[model samples]
Target: MVVILGGSLAAACAAPGSGNAQPTAAASSAPALSSAPTCGTEPVTMKGYFETGFPIAKALTDEFTKQHPNVTFDIREDQFAVITQNAPRVLADDPPDLMRLPQVSELVKNNLLKNLDEYAKVFGWDKWPPSQLQQMRMAPGGAVRGEGSLYAMGLNFSMTGVFYNKKLAAQIGMTTPPATLADLDAAMAKAKEAGLAPIAQFNGGATGGLAFPLQDLMASYGPAAPINDWIFQKPGATIDTPTNLQATQHLEKWIKAGYFWKDVNAVDYATMMSRFMKGDGLFMFNGDWESGNLDKQMPGDVGFFLMPPVQAGGKQAAMSAPLTFGVGANAKNADCAATFLDWVATDTQARTIGVQIGGSHPMGPADAPMPPIAPGTVTESTLAAGAKIAEDNGSMDFIANATGAIYAKSWTPNLQKLVGGEQTPEGLLKSVQADYVSQVKGG
Candidate 1:
């Protein structure tokens, strides 16, 4: 999982037990309670390992236990980078019933993740839109994705865009969401001129938070297909392209103009969000995962919009992908875990939790009724932006998810260098492409 910054999906590799250890509530290994696994009316404690900083999973688990008193969750939480580094060993040695998964190709290759094909049949997930599950499929040996056996499921489909401080925007005379890249730049310039941080971004720690805005810039300058192809690991795919370079240069311009905080490279995701919420920044490049949080913390003060394209009326695009989780291949409660995954999508209460708590589009059949959102809340705006992205067919997976180690090893460092003036925009893309090529070749 490449950490998506605010709601990261970045992955890293480390020796077993090398990263900070999470507190395990249960013993490392739990015995299988039943040979024939089913979500039976028996006492069950589902062990889950979830990413920290997001309340949706915990909220959903609490609701699930409310509905199924016989079932309960014993969940552990950790940062996304720690989870990425520790995933392999955890899956191999003391697998949880369900866990937040990073990129699944490598895990599927190692058989660490359970194939959910049978669960799809039992839960009628096969009847859902094919595109809903497309990103979770992987070929044999995990050499390719977007096709093959299903290995994971999402709590909800999340999308990324620009989240703004409405009060600050009004101060800068930004009455409406920017309609183009030039418009967006002008808004940022106004914010900066007003002595406000234009973009409160997180580029520090183990995730390259700048990747969020950079990727959005990529979509604005060109089509999302090439970016998706690169992330999906199509043969001969490359990230160092002309359009992307133009995008990179634009981001460099933002940095040069002091749109971001001077110490942005030192601020972690939590700090960035905290500052943004406190009105320290006028804009934030983030995902819908923060919509619910913002709605609660700031109420109607925040607004969201898809990253506008280079020109007004140009097709819009966004980094839209699933908030993926998977059952461990050797889980002691596979049946209950699969049941939980299915419930997240189809159960009315669970789907509502996904929308109101997860701040993402619920993954289910196309006709599934959406939970109502307050007309002017950030969640409503984000969901509306998601609809526009869907209508334009401009969804893309995060660039950090191109490979398991690429986020931590390549993008984060190169992007950090770009921020520090140690790497030029062209050099940043070239260096990342080199690392990507090596990783693709299993270096």
Candidate 2:
């Protein structure tokens, strides 16, 4: 995903391009909003914020520089929060040649993003189906609308699921993993009976420790149903609804039952990750991005599965969204940055980099006749099985960054309140609904 600090989209439903056919906007003759080519001209300087740390940008810069020897990649790294605060300021002073944004909603709400609707067509976004606008928190048109343009070319997609220790499961005499909420309950109960910590969560980190779990809850209904009506749109959904109520009470039951480690709340990202990798907790909820680190974290084998739906045969919502890249709205050598972004978005080399490094690209390294993972790592089958679980569920649009934080902030406090026995699900729902209604609608 690409965003120029400025330049812009609106009005009229441009038909969703037929099939995965890439669309070309009518930008051949028009001046590029934020940049132009840098192959032979002034040095193109581009800046970006990387998610998995500086190594990602370092890797991409190395690869990108190899092609455009004249282009200089000026990349920075920060926690997603720092980047969020920095974006508007950067746009206010000078937007970099590029920025890697985590959520689709940022480009939308801040108006710092530049639209790529034209770039999509020129770059064949349809051919790169995963490169389309990230739909995490926004509605269909929200990305282009909020950012004043379609400012990102998304890459590196992942789905939501749970990871667990197979060794731990076997120790409890459970052969099959959980396939439903009941199964999960049984697993939790057994883990408790066997004197295991049972489950793990890095709630103190992000997603209020509920990002993937919330997606799991929503998955039971179908990909779009929960997000479109309940979580995303908030269509005045009531806690009184059986499904909502079930979702509300279900996880809390485990928490109260001593299914979770007591220290989970005290452990943030670093500590939690260390424990997950080193400890004997039975289950973890996270994306595959954690797999490599997890391989190192666990003294025993680490694997994953999709938590089953509450309702049998219910649709599973696969959480996949764009780790969107964008053109800086205020790029100095705008053309060069645009070219670099285009190269990253379209070139096979750039795509392959992501594939190799466990970054987001169409193919996973393990997808082939099977690429080699590190030694002492989990089997490709284990990872693929988890991926297939997410795939089977239908990829739900990821919850965009902006709304994501809202949920994390709101959801966690409310969930803590409910689980700690300070509030009921209905009260929690009303509290959250009021907050969303007030903040989202400015009502």
- Candidate with best TM-score: 1
lDDT of 2 by residue, 266-323 (tens): 5565565667666557887767666545665563477666657766666555565556
Q: Which runs of model 2 end up more than 4 angstroms from their true locations?
A: 1-42, 51-54, 102-110, 130-149, 205-207, 221-223, 228-241, 311-314, 333-335, 345-348, 359-393, 397-405
Residue 68 displacement (Å), model 1 = 2.8
- Candidate 1 segments exceeding 4 Å error: 1-38
Query: What are the C-alpha RMSDs, in order, of all predicted structures?
Result: 8.7, 9.3
TM-score between model 2 and native: 0.78
lDDT string for model 1 (134-230, tens) is: 7898876678788777889999999899999999999989899999899999999988888999999999988889999999999999999889889
- Candidate 1, residue 163: lDDT: 93
Q: Quote the lDDT for 48 in model 1.
A: 98
